[model samples]
Target: MNAEIIAVGTELLLGQIANTNAQYLSSELAQLGINVFYHTAVGDNSSRLKDVIKGAQQRSNLIIFTGGLGPTKDDLTKETVASVLSVELEHDQKALNQIEQYFQRTNRHMTENNKKQALVLKGATVFPNDNGMAPGIAYKNKDCLYLLFPGPPSELKLMFDKYGRSFLLEQLETKQFMESRVLRFFGIGESQLETEIEDLIDSQKNPTIAPLAGEGEVTLRLTAKDNSLDRVTEMLNKVEEEIQRRVGTFFYGYGTTSLHSELFKKLQEKKLTISSAESLTGGSFANELTSFNGASLVYQGSIVCYQNEVKEKLLNVSPQVIKEHGAVSFECAKQMAEQVRQTLNSDIGVSFTGVAGPAEQEGKPVGTVFIGISIKNSKTEVYTLKLSGSRNGIRNRAVKYANFYLLKLLS
Candidate 1:
């Protein structure tokens, strides 16, 4: 069944808060085979809210409302929905008792306004709130279903999982299982990847293919829907294989894998330790890798040698080489990688050196970068890039390049 989520709060419109509730609900609904077609955020005004609710009722069979379920007068979600549906509001005795007991346990006096949370719509199934005072409601009118949830995420999550999930599943009779697989790729643009797989995507029927690009990477999500879970998984596997066959060299780990994490995975699997010598990137590559848990096993450390003196003194690059080719050259990057591996006595070494600025440096133009990778007893290779972006952009792309190069060597 198709659904729409309505978030009620002025904080969202004013940018005081983010609408994370919609993101969470949409993901959960998708897993249940329910399509969330629209997301609407309205302020605390009852008139505007009533209009939104009335409009949603016409197009959507299932409407989930979040926020404005509190004691204050501004918390008007239930009131607005009741008015829109011409449903009577009545106080639930069990909910009122629970609220009173909570206040008694805390040794505090219960205010009259607090009882407003106990009010429920006539013929609605009351969802007991274990984490908050405001009880939520799920009710069906004619052929439409309305679900009310609390504003706070902690309370809303518990109530929805405890009660709302069963209600929706029963109403829709959603019994089919859906499976999805994500294939991540780097060193290739989204348009290029899509072009290569255009025929496969056009020929898709049972397993659908959708490409998404973000932050220097592209992902293809393949989804298959079937009544039997194993059958759906098998269908997704076949589709994934076909796509990978065309562009598998550019592909990395599957499902939420990042470049740094993928490199870290290889390092751990081989039981190999690595270190980095950072120049243009200023240790960002190392920082990203170390952010994951238990990174110490694969990552030794990093040295940010932004100056020629540091490169010469710490990494022991020959002074003559710097004078001849400059620090941003291919030779300097290769030496930086080899020296760091030798100095730290690591199994692998990676390096980044580039000109990242609005102006050129050392006869090299801005966005000129060289990424070096060195493995023990193996030939060191440097990948040159003439990227286009600001300093941070260049540095970010350089890091990705460094990881991609290292991943290629490791693989």
Candidate 2:
């Protein structure tokens, strides 16, 4: 089924609030094998909203709406929809009782206007709202299905996930369930990954493969649709294995797993403690790892040696090394990693030293970065990179590269 999501609110148009509801609904609908072709945001004007609804109804089978369901005067979603459908709003007793109990529990007086929240279409599937006053409405008009949901994210998510989904599921005659898996890769460009599997993507039918590129990483989302779980799993596994066979060395983890989390897991599994010495990144790598739970088991600490004086004094990077190879060089990065590992008494030490954008430093151009990794019984390794972006972007990319190298080493 195809759908168009309409966000009804002036605040969305004015940028006072975001239309996140459209994103949520689109994702949910995609899992049900429903295609979401358009997302439109219309203000509180009734005539314009009706026009949008008419246009959507002409193009799509499902018309989903978020917002404008309230007791206030500007809340005209149901009223306008009723006008278009040639139906009048009818008071739902169960909804009205729930609203009364809500006001009573909160020790508030229930005004007559509060009854507006309980009004539904003449004949509609009513979804009870445990989180708010307004009840959700789902109505069918000929070949089109109209769904109205509360604007508040908390209420809308609960109502849809708990009740609305079941209603839609009952209507679907042959359920074609879709499962998607994201394969994340670092140290590889999106175009490179896509080109490697261009033939596979071109020939794919049952499982669709899509490549997405981010700042310093790439992801391939493979979606498989099937009636049986085992058949879908088998198809997905076969495709995943084939993709991995082609580019398995660069592929790290799957399904929202990132470089930092993968590195932490590997370090914890090996019972190895790690420390970091940062330069341009300013401990961002350490901060990222520290945000995860149970990080203290493997994350020792980090030293932000942003200045040359601190690099020389705290991280024990020699002035001669800085003078000879510069602070952004492989020598300085290696020394920083080695010194931090020894000083912090960690099994693994990582370091980042770089020249971010806006200005060159020590005869090195901007975006020149060196990431260092040192293990107790092994030699220190330094990887050099020439990134592109603003100063903050370069620094962020430097931190990400540090995490990527750590994950690679641990793997």
Task: Please give, for residues 1-411, the per-residue lDDT of candidate 1 as tens digits.
Answer: 889999999999999999888888887786676878999999999999988988998899999999999999999999999998899999999999999999999999999999999999999999999999989999899888999999899898888888877777888775766667889999899999999999988998878899999888899998887778889889988888888899999998789878988888889999999999999999898889999899999888898999999999999999998999999999999999999999998998889998999899998899999988899999999989999877899899899888888888888
lDDT of each: 0.90, 0.90
TM-score of each: 0.96, 0.94
Worst 10 residues of 1 by lDDT: 171-180
**Model 2 alpha-carbon miss at residue 194, Å:** 1.9
Model 2, residue 66: what's the lDDT? 95
**How many clashes does the backbone of model 2 have?**
0
Q: How accurate is candidate 1 locally (lDDT)?
A: 0.90
TM-score of 1: 0.96
Candidate 1: Cα lDDT at 263:
89
